[model samples]
Target: MSDSPRTILVVEDDNIVRMLIVDVLEELEYTVLEAADAAEALAVLNNADQTIDLMMTDLGLPDMNGKDLANRAREIRPDIPVLFASGYADSVDVPEGMHNIGKPFSIDQLRDKVKGILGN
Candidate 1:
């Protein structure tokens, strides 16, 4: 892999939640991009200059749902990894090859999940 830290695109409609996630990820030494909704997320995804290794999105987006956004993102970056965050995480049935984390996740849990997905 490249020596640069992995870049993560975080898509959460809630400004506070998005900021917290962005702060935590940045604290963990990863590059973070923020999007308040699916439309903004798509804008980032469509940007060829941006390097997004993984996407961490909330299932309850203001515009499109996380699954829809993930599908759209894949249309642009087919192999991009997706991590879904949901309040009902235990009941969420994420698609194969995708991952999910419960809302209000601890900092350790977030760190571990991202690390596991990114193979860190």
Candidate 2:
């Protein structure tokens, strides 16, 4: 593992939900970048300077769905891990190499999910 902390990009349309996720991730000692919508999230993904270890986006975004955003993100960063957050996590059909977590997840769930995806 690298010495620097792993960074995660969080994309959610709901302000409160996004804030809560960011706070929880930060508390878990991961560097977090936040976006309110798909456009913002794409902007971050397009920036070559940004070192994002993983992306956790809400399935229901104001502009685009999480799956679409993840597709575009994969185009930009081919190997980046994508984690989808949804109220209907059990029903979500994430493709291979992608993951999903239910809404209202406990902090421990989020931490474990991220660690599992990042392999740390």
Candidate 3:
């Protein structure tokens, strides 16, 4: 990975899951931005000056669904890559070229997917 810190937006409703992802990304030396729902995610994206390198979002949310959030984020930041994490593997239809990490994923799996998306 490059020495420069990459910014990652994590939109997850589950507090534990969100924190786990934040911790992992932090350990990998990436700057992490967190959102509990789509609204917060959009707010963060709207206020961000630089491009967000990656986004890891849960498929289900209290507000808008993660897939919709990802779509909206893509509209504003087309270059940013998205990774959807969900237990409902068969339910959500992820965007083309986007990535998905099943709910019970291992740390290695998460790391590999993020690395692959960032082209590390």
lDDT of 3: 0.87
Backbone Cα, N, C clashes tallied per candidate:
0, 0, 0
- What is the alpha-carbon lDDT of model 2 when measured against the actual structure? 0.94
Candidate 1 clashing pairs?
A: none
- Better-scoring candidate (lDDT), 1 or 2: 1
lDDT of 3 by residue, 39-69 (tens): 9999988875755888888989899988888
| Residue 2 in model 3: lDDT | 55
- TM-score quality measure for candidate 2: 0.97
Show where candidate 3 strays beyond 4 Å. Answer: none
- Tell me how far the alpha carbon of residue 78 in candidate 3 is from the true structure, in angstroms, after superposition: 1.4
Q: For residues 34-79, write the lDDT of model 1, one tens digit per residue.
A: 9999999999999999999999999999799999999899989999
lDDT tens readout by residue for model 2, 1-120: 668989999999899988999999999889999999999999999999999999999999999999999999999999999999999999999988999999889989998999999987
Which stretches of model 1 miss by more than 4 angstroms? none
For candidate 3, the TM-score is 0.91
Ranking by TM-score: 1, 2, 3
TM-score, every prediction? 0.97, 0.97, 0.91
Point to the candidate with the largest lDDT: 1
